[model samples]
Target: MADPTDLNLPEEREHVYKQQNDDVPASSLNSTPSSSWWSSLLAASGLVSPLDFAFVLFSVVYIFFLGKFAFPPQSDDPSKDPPVFKAEGIMVKTGPAFGAVLGLALPIAYIFHGVLEGDQEGIEAAVPHVFLLASQAFMDGVAYSDRFSTPIRVFMPVFFSAKKIFTLMDWVGNEFSKVCVGGGCDAAAERRVLLGRGLAVANLVFWSLDLFC
Candidate 1:
């Protein structure tokens, strides 16, 4: 007995919608949820969420595009005024891909950092040799600058030589930054790597466990 156009119920609504398909605006279709609302709902889900997945996926694709298509083609060109620092260019363009790699590597690095502490001793012991080598070049410059009888003349010229002074200071500063006592350095790098990996793995495991609760 109800009017054919009476679209109060679901069936009637669909019928009316179909009837008005030509006349109805595209926005009035079975589009119940608004786009923004739907997107938020999808985003609320984990990495399984389509919206979040698509965003990350597209972003990664864009990075690949930049690296493969944009950056190397343009930046690596020898014709560029000042050649782009290839390492920095690659880093910026491939950041997302690199980040994902680093994320996994970070945890592993941390777990093994303390174990690798002894490896740095060999590396640290080589520092004094580096300094000694660097000093030889610098002292040679000082000796060569000894044209004047005035000792200050030789000393000042060597000290003021930006390249020579920088070389010596760089070696000394780098060695001290390693946190060595006398001839040995601390495990600072290893400790940091270990802490990062441990925390990352801990958080990831905790999050997975919490999901069941």
Candidate 2:
């Protein structure tokens, strides 16, 4: 019988004494992870990426804005109860609420389908993102409404100088587009993901000083 050690190449024999711990999996070495983004981001910056934080922030903010904020009650004494909300504000909120539901619902349905097909890698990430964008859209709609803004002047005269809500509308719309596009296992998925992240960075840049409506 031939000795196995005798079959080793000269280079392999010389390096055989060293530890051979290079047991990386081919899948990891060859392709990017479906959502290694969070850890990779933390590794690179020693903090959560602004976009990831923004995604959660917008979700929490808009959820509170839409589902929880209490408007000041109307009163006979104008000074005592400044008009900060209007009847139309309630009606105006519907559009964004509907948009938010639809935005969140669409991706959730997609995730459900993926689960049925046994692709569980992305279902968790996609669900909250769509919800966040939807919330942002809702905030945009409410804040931009004159019905909501008209009354704020009495409470905080300098709250909105002019046309600022419209700016929020535009920024949220831009973000909504990114979240809308950032899904699926299509060929352009990587690009869509990057653009969706840009939405978060944009939020930090443009929507950081957001005013409550």
Give lDDT per model, in order.
Answer: 0.31, 0.34
Best by lDDT: 2
* Clash count per candidate: 3, 0
Which residue pairs collide, candidate 1? 107-197, 110-193, 110-194
lDDT of 2 by residue, 1-213 (tens): 221111111011111111122353312222222122322332344233355446445544543354335443244322222233333443333432343233333444545564675544344345344333433332333332222322332322122212234433443454445443535556555554454445434433332332333
Kindly report the root-mean-square deviation of model 2 from the true structure over all alpha carbons. Answer: 24.9
The list of candidate 1 runs beyond 4 A from truth reads 1-53, 56-186
| CA RMSD of each candidate after superposition | 29.1, 24.9
Please, what are the lDDT tens digits per residue for candidate 1 over residues 144-163? 22121223222322232332
Give the TM-score comparing model 2 with the true structure, all chains together: 0.26
The worst-scoring run of ten residues by lDDT in candidate 2 lies at 4-13
